[model samples]
Target: MASPPVILLLVSLLFCIATQRLYAEQAPNYTFVKEASEVSPLQGRFDYIIVGGGTAGCPLAATLSSRYRVLVLERGGVPYGNSNITRLENFPRTIADDRPDSPAQRFVSTDGVISSRARVLGGSSCLNAGFYSRASPEYVAHLGWNGTLVNESYPWVEAVVANVPIVQQWQSGVRNGLLEVGILPYNGQTFDHIVGTKVGGSIFDAEGNRHTAADLLEYANPDNITVLLHANVHRVLFRTRGRNQPLAYGVAYTDNTGSTHRAYLERNTRQSEIILCAGALGTPQLMMLSGIGPAEHLRSFNISVLVDNPGVGAGMADNPMNAIFVPSPTPVETDLIQVVGITPFGSFIEAASGLSGYAGATSNSDDFEPYLGIMSPQIGQLATYPPGERTQERIAEAVAQLKVAVAANNPAALGGGFILEKVFGPLSNGNLRLLTTNVSDNPAVTFNYFADPADLQACVQGIQTIEQVINSGSFTDFRYPQTSTAFLLNLTSSLPINYIPKHTNDSTSLEQFCRDTVTTIWHYHGGSQVGRVVSPTYHVLGVDALRIIDGSTWNFSPGTNPQATVMMLGRYMGVEILREREQS
Candidate 1:
């Protein structure tokens, strides 16, 4: 019944798949590439299809393929010979670096508020600092989740992949040390002896060098899991007996060459389930395209609503940490080092979690506070306004003041003495929306930070505290303006407010002077929550045989690198799925 042209196209595509399979076996760890000049239709199917094989997807694919036939669909090509991924030593910030940008950068634009995650096979982890921490037990307990910690979730993750630790001991930089001085006031005891007082533990003593799930994927058995590079998942193909409900059958996608088609397994092949580990942004975007989100929003976008789950794209939460930069008296060679966190007894109660205490115990040091990198979670609220609203503008204004304070303190940013204290969020309660019915089109991401005065207030206090430490301790040996004086001067000066830095007096401005200079460290969460977006079983509320397991499924942001948590989730989900399939 097929037309001559269609039959010819199918024949050509089949030949390409056979050829690639042959090459894949020969170079198991390398990219099996067809030149950009080769045109071929993407037509293939597997029992389980995972889109975006990054942090969560890679682990899930490796785990699930242990038994069932699994196919991972990735938008970016494999980095076979790319120096960025291969060079384990250079873990610098991926922004503007030659490394392939992650999907998280997709949402970001010239304006700071809207940002996107990475879109490669290894996802954002491909571009991240390789910081690893198991999600604290508190985050799961608060959400009534049973398994989300290092012991429960991490061990399995570690078994399949490596959680590389710091190879050697390193000391905190001047900025972090100075910031620690400010929190000392909250503790009456000597800062050194107080458990959970000073942040440490960035030290890793030559434990197995940590590697990513991508590394495992290449080294794992090739016969079971087939990674189709340069393949983009366009949509989930659904079939319904009538109009009552739709059953997910297969997927439709386009290869690098631009030919598109629908694919399904042979006549009798059956899959017990399909797991969606496409990550926070991609998972929800795929769901929206598949008609599995808020009915009203779907209708607005002309996307047919498959399951009317109002919480599908709601409850987006992120950490808004303020960075405290301190000038060092002398420059020293250093890699990544841990800066301790000090929290008052009342502060822990205020944050509504006991993680401060737990983290202190696990690290075997009295400084039982959190350690922050760009990925560390700091508590602040900026949600006093809605996304793209007035509150965000106010935050931008506050950030501008903060930038001027730094410029005044350090005339040359290129010097090692200059530290950038970045405050991440006064989190905005934003949601992910489908920009178009097509899954490939980027979705709209708006984190409406600075919506609440409380969010700004918390950060304001953090800066004030950090400033006090620098002015009082051995830090006083250096020249810098007191936050109080700087803030007071800003109050007196009738300065025009803007998001750009300007000249300001170092001695006269108050702490409030440097407020609006904070920006997001790219920590995103909650758009696709556990109880809200998916059921406790990790399945789409009304859709059978489909579940979401990734960072987006997080109930609350844990205030740190989500890589460990996301990887753990994939491992747990894969085991659960396989177990259930075996029982059935």
Candidate 2:
């Protein structure tokens, strides 16, 4: 029944997916990459030593490798061919996995919200929902970036690690629902960080395979890049000059075998450097460890101070998020944040559906053999370690249940999805500090969600917008109601915010909803700002030949998702570094 043009498009897409999968499997073999243990001396000199081979680090290393000998030291293993990260449907499990070797590192902030950061070579780009939107024009100008160079850098990142997503059944419905709520006139599809409803780009390909920043390493001259995995950098080595600021010379890192190794920039290499792309949390933590932070704080850890600066881990901020879960009438296709509703009140609405079970194989007493329980016709439950549950049996039961539910046209029987809102430009801020001298341990951070009254007001507005979308005609088919009226998601407040009349006695209830349900979108930034801790060129202040390039540099998050700008930043700076050297 389909038209020829539509059918031909589908065929072409399928072919493209198949080709990408084959290309991934047949990726280039780089003889330069090795486990830290494989390298004998474990000490060398390079033109640049970049710590943390993450979303930004990989691209920066690849670009710099074209002109200089570059070394990238990643504390985690590779993400290639990892099913947990590659498959779009396995997102929940990937975020919930908490093992020591897992690519996702789970941590709870002092503010009491659960979050995760990437420990894989591709960095958080490997762990995120794969959304790709550039920084707003306002943000680019605010940072004093070269507008021409910034524009030129984006396509390079997109060509290797991004794609135009195929908007499907669930996403299409959400997009309509967003428009119905009066979020704006639809902007159709775009990768720009604009104001309106739009289908954003993704790092995931048509085949449900994730192409991470690690894939950008293909652009590197393999002969010039020496990447070492399982390399945990401890501190930056510095050489002090008489009555002058110290100069960073190298780094000391521990390998998988608990043996330490030192890698450095040659003493005579002109304008050589050490770069930290260890992310917001890791970069500031490393600076403090290297005795470059608050004098009293570094003294507490028995680290002798080289340069005292209290700004190392100040101004920590994360966008607070709230959500509602709605079950659908039919199976929704697997997707993550394909459509977004950019609100006028500094909030962004997004959704993801069909995430699988959340069970991680951790060596804890709580590890359980989970089973699906049909508690009632309308409800399903997860069992914790029910005697001896087999993986095959669990799969069989799930498939059988799904088939029956679909045949019966039972909306309540199907798995539900989530609609979430995250407030932008959060005024609230917190700080990050070390618990011990161990650089390997997760540091203590507190992102004071909704600490500012202004942020709470924005959250109230965003939630009200979501209420309109839920009550809209476009979303009616997605919900199964028990009554002719309506039912609201209970977010564990005094009552669901929508249940009360809009002209209620007090607006205090809506503010209460913001505090009680505060969560994270994991878009945290600003431990090291450009003006405070680093120069406009990302060079660390008061330290020679050291630079920091990552999400930590920004006081304001670039876009709804920060990965696109972060990746672009790396490439932009890399080109600048090469151009400076060439001109000189």
Candidate 3:
């Protein structure tokens, strides 16, 4: 044995080595600036300026930073230390919080459909249901994307945040029920596109910690990337010459301190570009603000039209979700989405549990007022327009009536249970338009949920399919004695209301119930669609040095949860951008 003094010294050296390694792992390697002043004089130019440090933005920035000097400006704060955001149990709180700066910014549509978008650095990936699935192979082919590149890029994202979910008792039953209902032959657990009931990946790891796209920044080149949080880019700066197409050279943004800043691309470099990774709403809003939208709409707001592109904010689509709250006699395990039922009829069914307590405890009317206060101005404007005027008025009136109905009863809160959401794929009629010139103002969004008629029929079928699954033998023991809608209405029957009862088994009643309660499952896409708003290469039409790579770029909604597809597209764009620069 060595002497005591020698042993002590050796132990000390080992401890020091371990300490350094621990610090290295814990400390972030990339340059993260919280304020604009921190990075001022702002470096004047960057090889790439990516707005919206979101699901697509984070990975895109990471990939580009490997070979280029990149700047990522995010409107929300970093996601590292937010407790409500990090914990799975607090998922509802994060989405329900009405504060203006909440991680999930809630909004009610022109048609009174309520939904939200992620306002954190990782975008919706930070606020979503954590379900992860790739776009169907048909969707991939529809976009005509480079299939080999897409296949290779998915692993890069999966390696960072994807995990095999722990299938609890409730989830296992869901899987069986899905199969029994003719949703498949079970495809088993997979990340691939299979036309059957399957278990998909999740962003939540084994410990239930959410790994967001922001985590992918760990792969970034520390020396080449600068991520600035709360840096909201309001518009893309454009330079125009007498009749030639406009060129985007920079962006104007406001930092957390309300200080304005501008970042530009170098004049001589063809490689420099400004990419918008802002989600469906933000991306199109920015395009219209920067003068790239409908000429008449832009002119109404006194915005100088740069491109006269009518398609910038058109064709918005969302998964119209109808809920069935099955009250469990015993508390079910608190979980996010695990098992998914993909119907051949273009609607996808997924189940989530442990939110019944929250849903029951909160009265809709009490929550409706504040949410409406933020949205009323926009909806009020839509009510002034033609074609949708009557529909908008009815929605506003329904919300107003619900406020009156819930306040008097103050319904008893239900215990923890499950919620089933039915997501429908792309319908071509939804739209988003600027309500005002201000970038901070929420845009007017209309999902046109049931306008397609075929979409409405699909939803009606989907609701029936889920009811079948819940009523199946697999869920016999766990089944609620009453239908979910009946339990929901029982919690609120203070008056002799004229509306239909929740337990009405007829197709007409179910269809009516769907129309009354239909809201977004929060999968919003296609404001800046590929081949219309932007080229297939992800570059904006009628403008040089500008690109958009986010949900807004999708021509239509993916058949499954869109975050995985969005990330894959981001990775593809980042790789293609680099390749293009090299070729140029």
Candidate 4:
């Protein structure tokens, strides 16, 4: 009925709409300098060189690139299109992958605590559980940071990667359980730190796609920033002028092809700086390698001490966790740390449901039996005995039963596991020391978990609190009826021998249990404490043109998950660096 011209216009509009939809659905094509050869004849100078293009490094580089030539050297590959890094459902598999170059780099501490650190461009933010929360106001003030500036800076990173979590059924149950146990009136969905049950922000979006810190680079001035992946910085290169303190002028790094490359600061500008955002483990390790650790420790390795900052790799702390795995008879939708219970006792009890089960194992040889046993403190005690001894008998029995359950594809046994993690705040002590002069070798990491009696007591109390939540009326229907692995085939089984808490109310048994089962929540901090290794302004003490702006500089771990604090610190540092540059 329309005129010929009108008909043509209608067809054109349809074509445009379809084209736009197609474009919107298409994945982003990221251009990365993955090979050393790609940066042929690497530039001799950059205004700022950020080591470790990680959670902090990415945002810092993005901010600095607005006015300066910034270089970000990441030891790992890019996360673009990597399923393990982008998909929420792939959480466990990603961290469990043992490949040296995988996004997750698994390492065991000297105390037998097993964990992993991120190796990808986004670092641990890309591999972590994706929970996000702001640092407690008290914690922010403790650092003597400009509280006003910090509050202003949080939104810059939050706008890019943070999201209000989508609460599913399991998370809802957790919320109700916490309230029933008197965690207090619900704080609801919020990003601020409060003492109550609340749903905080997550890096994973509503569709279950993960948005990592690397995504913040979209705000960067690409023309001024060059991000090079697989660029492993071995040490900071320093220049000493007329007996002045050693000034960081450049860095020596290895590329993807194992070729050594050097990138230096422009001699013309005193504003040029080498910033270490390489995280708690990497930053201190790099400093020590550059002759900036305890004088005696460096001397023992025959490495010249650059600064003799004894605090460079001291006073490390990690949030130790004790978890309870609850299985379900029905399939539950996958979820993560959506609802958190902040207790008045300085402990955090969080519950997550719907992780993939044993049936999803990538290999037949994959042994999940160790994971089940490892989550308990009893396993650590069993390790002291020889393989066939009585101490090992209970575990062996539990493992056999678990294997049988897995083989039978029991809905109650195969899938639908919920984890209740009790993350304690700032009370434990640990340290990282160089094992070898070689940068590739992992440092000797020792988390003397629960070494302090107070920490042990807190963990024991935390476990008791978690049990209270689990036993609450809200979780009655969702709770797994089976308790004994030995008779798991029996539909009405009580508590599995493996699932039993070593001692329900006995402090000694609980303390022993904590020793065996406690592992890091991965909230590591203070390897280079503020005012110890670095000034409160975040510059390294007794050094020139060097700053640390990552978890390493935190005086103590925040009272909650530290990703939000890490990002906030990155933004705060970026602003400080900018201010300093303007003054210079």
Candidate 1's residue-wise lDDT over 1-584, tens digit each? 99999999999978765654343233334342233223244345567767667778887787777887776777775533343432332232233232233322434422244334666566766655454444545555665655533356566655544433332211333333444554443322211223232332211223212255565465344666667666667777777667456667767777766777555543354444556777667788888888888899989988877788888777665554334433333332223433333333211100000111111232234432222222211111222232234332454454343334334554211112212232333344677787777666667765555455655655566555545544554444332444343442343232322222334555533334444444445567766777787787787676655677787887555534466667766766777777777876
Model 2: residues with Cα > 4 Å off, grouped in runs: 1-28, 42-44, 355-413, 481-487, 491-508
Candidate 3, residues 1-584: lDDT per residue as tens digits? 89999999999978865653353234344565455656665865789999999989999999999998899999887666665566555465566554667777766677765567778888888877798999878888888888899999999999988999999867777788889989997999998867789999999876566778988888888888888877888989988977378888899998767888898887778778999999999999999999999999999999999989899998888777765555455445667788888888877777776422222345442433311211122223112223223243554564454445445542222233444556556563578998877777789998777777777777778777777877888876556565554544332222111122334333345566666656566788888987789988888999888999898877567757888988887788899988988887
CA lDDT, every prediction? 0.51, 0.77, 0.73, 0.73
Q: 252-360, model 2: which lDDT tens digit per residue?
A: 9989899998998978866899999999899999999999988999999899998888999999999887765566655566578888998888989888765223233
> For residues 1-584, what per-residue lDDT tens digits would candidate 4 score against the true structure?
99999999999878865644443243344453445547856756899999988889988888888899888889888776676567666565566555557776656666665666778877888877788889888888888888998898789889988999888777787789889989987999988889988998899887567788888888788778888888889999987777578899999998878888888888898888999988888899999999999999999999898888888888887777766566655555667787788887777878666534332353134544422222221222212322224233554565455556656775555444444455555666778999998776789887677777777787777777766766788876666664432222122112222222333322245456565556666777778888789888878888898999898887567756888778777778888888988886
Ranking by TM-score: 2, 4, 3, 1
At residue 67, candidate 3 shows an lDDT of 94
**Model 1 lDDT, residue 91, Cα:** 30
Between candidates 1 and 4, the lDDT winner:
4
Number of the predicted model whose lDDT against the real structure is largest: 2
Clashing pairs in 2: 369-385
lDDT of 3 at 365: 28
Off by over 4 Å in 1: 1-44, 85-93, 97-104, 109-111, 114-116, 144-152, 159-210, 265-271, 327-329, 334-337, 340-411, 417-427, 468-515
- On TM-score, the candidate that comes out on top is 2
Report how far off residue 254 is in candidate 2 (Å): 0.7
- Candidate 3: 10-residue stretch with minimal lDDT: 370-379
Q: TM-score for every candidate vs. truth?
A: 0.69, 0.85, 0.83, 0.84
List the RMSD of every prediction in angstroms: 14.6, 6.8, 8.7, 7.4
Instruction: Give me the displacement of residue 561 in model 4, in angstroms.
Output: 1.0
